[model samples]
Target: MKIDTVKGGAYALTCTEACTVQAIRADAAFITILEADTAGQYSFVAPGEAVEVSDENAMVTQVLKPAALGVTGRSGIQSGGDVVLRNLMAEAAAFSGIVNANGGIHVPLAAGAETDTASVNRAYAMGMAQLVLMHQTRTYWLTSSCTATNGVTINHAAPGCYCEVLLGANGGTSLTLPTTGTVSGGDYSKILGYSIPFRHNGGAAGTWIKVSMLIGAGGEWTESLDAGMDGYRFRPVSGSAPSIARLVEVTLYYHEGYKSRVRELIGVGKPPGYVVRTTESSLNYDSNTNPCSAAYRLVITQSEISYTSELGAVVWLVMGGASGDTVVKLADIRGWDTYHTSVSPTLYLDVQAGEYGGRVHLESPTILNGIGNNTYVRYGLEPYQRSWITAEAEVPYKEPEQPSAS
Candidate 1:
């Protein structure tokens, strides 16, 4: 008798009469066997990856099919005594075919949440090993203490993965560099020195000397310095010689392809249409000195605006400009000498100008009376077209979704 199990659910089978079981079949390419016994009972989980099961006849067979995207199923089979079992399910040529077709290999951060030196090193090593096996390139961030003796080392010695070491702040201390030699079947070419400028909280400037080692093809280690880094001589005499300058941080980066993709996958890359905001001070502009005009006006000079918006247009809005009255004035006045008067407390300026770039300005004149000191002027970019309808509108911020480990 043949029994069918539901997909993505667990199952167990038991033989009632004295009969031999032929095989366990599944629609998925992989099945995980939990347990089996001679007492005519079998238990297993089916269909996310590939697994093998042995029957009383000692016949090895592929028991499941590759699962559909995001589908997980499990199943099992059993048999009784005095029965001749035959091959029930078709066999696959090789395991690699299934994995390749399904895109099953995904190397996430090793110890993604850990910060300690040992955990970081171990996670880096594991990630690098996985990358090496897949023949892909990636850059890993490994955090370590500035006082560590051995520092961090890459034992796998593959060219695809670059290891970047992030050293924490150390006060006037010297760090030991990795020595030159063969390690884990890989040769270390030599140690390269780098001189970088350092300063603490606007203090006097000092020089920080550091060293890094590289691994070439076939486990050969060599010294390589990235661009924009100044080379220096590394000489350590006797014990650890502490420097007068404090070390804020040290980063040893290895260059490799696919860095941007790796950064995007790890949620560190900047998303499209990114925007940043910086708040400027609030000030009160005195009434115009011209006695004949008697108009209380506020001027937002070009120097106050420092950031450029992605869109060339600049939208300005002023609130509570007139005393006691509450009126709103909105316009796309790009050039200077634009005047607006309102009896209400609100004033709005919509300037559609990228010609001035980050130097856009706003000037509002209160024709009714002198404006109050509580007035506010805000300048920002409206990504869409400039219109009076969206004067008070805003765009909401959304967080990026991370890839699922499943």
Candidate 2:
């Protein structure tokens, strides 16, 4: 007898007739008929008796992470006349051709002003411009001023005492006088007055120090100095140069060496469904009605398949992305919204899907006592699958006696 089997866990069998020549030719066909001691069933196994199942699906194997490259150094060279240092910083950040990729950078500068208000206002304006720039290019800059070099001394009972002034960096042309009475080495003293930059107290105690309107002029701007009482030698790093250099530093920071894929997918074929993890909130809207925007974000995570020995190929699939907007980013987003209304009044980006990885567009209106009232909406993505099956069971099987008891 011979049998054949197919690939699908099934087989075929064949048997020859008892009177066939092949049967007669068998070597010693049971030499003589032997009676069986017991009767037994003889069965033939068929290939169809067994079944096998296999699965073949695609999955992510590895992910190439993103990288970031930050600006290392920047400086504003040279100087211009009558310009606001703070404004220069803002302008530099705005005009710098640095790619930010939704990331931001900060630049520092020197502070100059006579009154606290002047300094504070300058800082505020610079900060505001940075914010605006972030909306457009997503970078920022900050300015810092040098600390006071010397303290002022007031002759305890005298109405006014001649104070020694030092020269600091674009000819800090003018300086203020101390409001507090001085006799000390480490106490804080306020710089008063305007129009004349002065170096509180520095240089050799008894050294001859005199101020003149001109480099060596002996008239008009002439003033004599007593010993520098700040316990430090005060002398211009150079003869007499102004320190008011109106310059703003510029820099940029952004992620690099990282690649991304965006894809817009639609349900297709028998059961079409797609999943997406957004990088950020897509919700945006008019600001007049509701001042606040929604606070959720989406980011995508991916894995790339690299094992080629058995599988032979690798593909990356986005598993998930960050969700929930951080409070800090949310505040910035709110400020951006306010800026839009005050300046342009139009919300910029809309929800859209990518093509390479995953994309989805969704709407979430602000809920207001079932009335829905917020200006912008934010949302997170949830994964979904199509072509899935679900099953349910009927009531449990029971004996008739159980029914009678019931």
Candidate 3:
């Protein structure tokens, strides 16, 4: 029987019927027959009784638990330009398709620039259950007719390092420089700057290396490297005009890592049909704010269910994305707020994402329909963008009845 019995303590129960008193929570305590049944009380026993309190209330059975999955080899894949990633698993498997994925991605590819800022290039989520981690970007200032040589002191005086200057030259042009260098007290000598493994101090500071490369008459050079003393700057080798193909821009993407064979998440790879995430428009809803109707919406909406331990309402935004695609897509979801949000007595947040978009779901709590919010949430609508975000709680998650024999 269920009673507030502790390890070494006992309570009085004036039984009306004969029965065995068993600890409903076996792990909690043990019940042994205490006193003699003198005045019409037939002494009872622990677990089962001589003086009955219940007919069939006690049992001795073993319980088995699900196997534990190891969290080893679970790391994220860094992606962007020429870098596509496998699903980067977030905070464990909430269910099938949704994970608490968080990380950054670099889009090395640059978006085409428009002289008219009004014509902002439009971008879309990978679509479907595929999640959009983040959209990142940066502008560029193109230059021409610059000159630089080797042994240039960039960010430091002696031991500090310089930012990597990735260079791309137009035409049959090439750069000859040290592949590696070690700085001693602010100096590394110089060598024929074109060869790899050239030593510093020999390839050191103040030791000018000849700026040489195969350059066509109209060829130019571009680099992320800054200029320093001597010929350490990057420019035309000699007798070459800056080509039209100079430095323009770059972007990167970061993402989470996943093992397809292990965690069979249907939401990671292919488009899982329509998903309903968040809307870009700001609106006050009496019931629910439907997604706004427009073209190039770039986003779609659909639904499914998942789980969460968190009760109440939570706003899910695309924190960032990880992929090797060149173009970066940004999602602005913070322009949202909540009011009069209600939740289950006990619950967890579940997330569902698919082709339609992504949504915030609850982990099947009780009183399911009560898993909704009356507060209005919205975003600043732009000329060339659309959005989707989902609520993270669903209710009426009733515990299944114990199996019964027919």
Candidate 4:
């Protein structure tokens, strides 16, 4: 079964929700919708609105697929975990293929609800695919790092698969692999560091960092949790394995349908065009760094506030990387309105993408009282595997609009 492991993966499911017909919760072949026999208001209910099932059972749909498959070749739904659900040209022609991938989109999607055989409202519903990923952990001891004569495959390649390998800290050594690949968004370092920091935080939601500014500590069980579908072969970055005991886990996320056709999603990488990154950031009442490229927008899934100081905060953006940058104040983050610590709120900048890369910064209060420590801003990194095969829900595609600077 395809299960979204990240937050925001949960939409609302109300207790008193209605369905024209029964939708089997186990099937991803179709969608669940709220119907109205009177007004013909077949409008799409947001994953936001709640819906109830049975007398209970988490009124939410675990996964979904378009109702109909297009006649396009090699363009159908598939799953990350299930090989039984696949579509071939024959299947698409016969309309007998299974739609069950972790994260993927159509080849040439049909327009409107009628032609859109999938009836997916894709433009409004999906994103970089909300990837179907696989994760595994194992302990190994390496006395030496071998370059040649021994090429070991740690995790087998899956469809639409890019590979990433990491070294463990308990062994306290870094190893290099010849088979590892880099993501188009950035590099392995950014991918691992961005989310892991805030995720492991011990705060309420492990998002916000309070009163403490302790960074770069020693004996810190640091594991370069760098794993992605960067390439087909999953191997070490180089032969630089540590000479100690280590426990390592390699996770793979891919679109089941695009396994053989794995290509770049944004610039030049794999499918599911989205990259999310975070840092142990703090604003002296005025500063934040967006770990994303110009082609992407920054959203904080989890966050932390100042423990000693309660003040106003603003989520601002700087077009291009300059000190005297244009300050676009997106929204004001009121701590009083939200929980003081581990504050997780939705903050985004309403702006257009230009040829230049922009930065999302958090500005702290210039008018607040004395505080012992700087305001810590820890962003929770949610699992984001999305694809933009259509304009569905306004997903960006190819080059991300390198428009003239506005």
Candidate 5:
């Protein structure tokens, strides 16, 4: 049978007796097949798609009688198939399919605000099922750039299950997930490996980082950095501050019955034909300014680079001064909001006639520095740009089965 459906509509099919469904097909996407009742009832979301259901064996029965005698054949036997036996087999198959599709379990939401001690209805993960639960407990909607830490706790975590945390920040600041637990009564040592670090790369609001941790049967945790936007490297933490991850969204996946290895949760790669161009401009400095007293300022001329967004970039600095007078230190490369005392150059370009040029890599851009004497400085930069990976949660629909009479 074929059914025409409209967008955002729910459809259901019911049968008095058990029947075998050969196949189900849809023309459009977002089609979710759900079992609404255990008594031969099924439902699905069409999402404005055309759906077709084919049932070759549809509970048909035909009886054969003796020619001479008026004795009827066996009560449950039929020409097409054994009526009672076929019904039982078909129903069993349908139930199996439902259980597999719904991840072998259903968890109802619990009371109380979501926090480190939040709990949900208990359920088992049987067969080769993968149950995923998503929650957003600590989230910050910032009007300005600031550093903050956030975390969530998952109680009664199933063995072999894992959790993923999506973190995002603004204002070219750092967002870190520490190895030590920051949440009260929370033990991060259960998670294996060191801390996870994520640099926003000084981009706009949407850039995010993904951190994944697998829970062992003994409650030991194995951690991995799934993916990050471009310009942000994923590596072990080296004495960084506690997690400044401004926004936190956690997803828990139960892989108790899963036999195979867990795959990477997120995909990260750049598009084709992507390139970075170098932007060069001359620095302006006042000669009357005391070299020992005041610092010389350098501003990026690129219109695409904004102070409010996209802060970090790669810069090439070249300065000309007397033998003893040369550029000595970099004060603040991250604009006026944050300051860095002295930073070493990533790569040295040239050093001649009291002239020095080097590649200065900064986490935040719009360079400001202090020079030794009256000098000329020229700068170049490869603006910050990156490809983002967006993480999404997919949950199956399930309805509680009604209790049968005693």
Candidate 6:
């Protein structure tokens, strides 16, 4: 069954704590407000408060939707190994749709709750691998000249290894140049020695120096560590593979509190005659990226944050297509600007219609650094297979029909 088939009821459960309702459920084709009567005050269920529904096991799933209480989608790279539980959406929807035919939202009881990471690491390690590769590449400049050298034989080192230069007897040092060739010595061959390319590790003092002051030792016959003492920085070494640059940026689009402003500006209904790219051929409506007009599908789900006719908490936008609506789905979200005032959080969505050469605009309020800037925008690359989409909660919507009548 589709999500719309389920019945939903809105009732205020508590009067003291912002008069918010704790849960919502589907009772047959109708929705029932959980704990509405017991709380003694169920009139506070405002336009943007919490929403709860029923689950598959005939149990109640609290805050399963992004609009529910304590529900949050936290994104980050896993630091260590760990095991965690994530509710698979498609399966949950299918399972929940079977009996009730009404979908449910599962609220995470462990927001900010610490959990073990042993098993989670195994799976999340994929993301961490990218960071590790970046670090390693940056350290050696991604060149093949950073390997250790073998002291046994002239050619016994690895493909990218370096050879050392020995200090000769006549105050001269034996430098093993990167190339292999013969050297000729003339009369002043003592000063005009074979060219041996070498390098040093800028020692303990953190002073950056390739070669220490060349010392003149008349001529001594000795084969020891001092023979290669005077340090030199590592020379230019070639690698088997060529080097290349890797610079990647991943941007995530989320609600920046613009949803709250929509309520104050224009609450729901027909979305203020917003224009969507349609084609000249027919009028079915485009949701995915439409080559004909550059129109695309974007997912937008709504829920109530703290609410009342005058004030309320901000709403969140979910990734993916909106329920039963596709106009906003296909629009491209672009442009971003951060504002200073609580009323001016940077939010600007530039919906471009390339195929048709047109554009639409979207903006929202955002909060930053503990202040309510209340605006934000979506930017960069368009939709990828598994990306995210967040809708502003303030954008108004048609209030779902009440269960008692429908």
Q: What is the C-alpha RMSD of each candidate to the true structure, in Å?
A: 29.6, 37.0, 30.3, 28.3, 27.8, 31.8
Instruction: State the lDDT of candidate 6 residue by residue for 1-406, as single tens digits.
Output: 1122122322322222222223333332333333322212222122223343222112222222333332212221123322232432342333323343235444443434455553465446566555433321100011122121222122223232233222211222121222211123122212110111122211111111111111112111111121222111211122211111000111111121111111111121232211111111121223342221221212211111111222222212223222332223221211111111112111111111112222121111111111122211121111222212333232311222222100
**Of models 2 and 5, which has the larger TM-score?**
5
Candidate 3 structure quality by residue, lDDT tens digits, 98-210: 43346634434345545343233233323311221111111111112112223321221122111112111110111222211222111111110011111111111112111
**Which digits, one per residue and each the tens of the lDDT, describe model 2 over residues 1-406?**
2222222221111112111111111342322111111221111112232212111111111122211112111121112312122222222333335454343345343466567767787889889656433322110111021112233122222223222223332111211122222222121111110011112121111211111111111111112122221111122222232221100100000112111122211111233122111111222122221101121222111111111112111111112114221221110000011111111010111111112211111111111010022111111111221111122122211111111100
Model 6 weakest 10-residue run by lDDT:
242-251
Model 5 TM-score, 2 decimals:
0.16
- Please list the C-alpha lDDT of all candidates, in the order they appear: 0.23, 0.19, 0.21, 0.22, 0.22, 0.21
TM per model? 0.14, 0.12, 0.16, 0.17, 0.16, 0.16
* Model 6, runs deviating above 4 Å: 1-67, 70-162, 165-406
lDDT of 5 by residue, 139-183 (tens): 111212222233312121221121122232221112322121122
Q: Which of candidates 2 and 3 is the stronger one according to lDDT? A: 3
Which model scores highest in lDDT?
1
- Residues 1-406, candidate 4: write the lDDT tens digits: 1223222232233223323322333333434443323211122223322233332322344334323232221111123222232444444443256755567565566556465545655744453122111111111212132111112222313211222222122111112311112222221111111111111101111011111111111112222211112211222223232211111111111121111011211111233222111111221111232212211222111133322212233333223222232333222222221122111111111111122211111221111111122222221111222221211121222222222211
In candidate 4, stretches whose alpha carbon ends up further than 4 angstroms from where it belongs are 1-87, 90-100, 110-299, 303-406
lDDT of candidate 3 at residue 357, scale 0 to 100: 28
Q: Could you tell me how far off, in angstroms, the CA of residue 237 lies in candidate 1 after the best superposition?
A: 23
Q: What is the clash tally of candidate 2?
A: 48
lDDT score, residue 121, model 6? 51
Preferred candidate (TM-score higher): 1 or 3: 3
What global local distance difference test value does model 5 have?
0.22
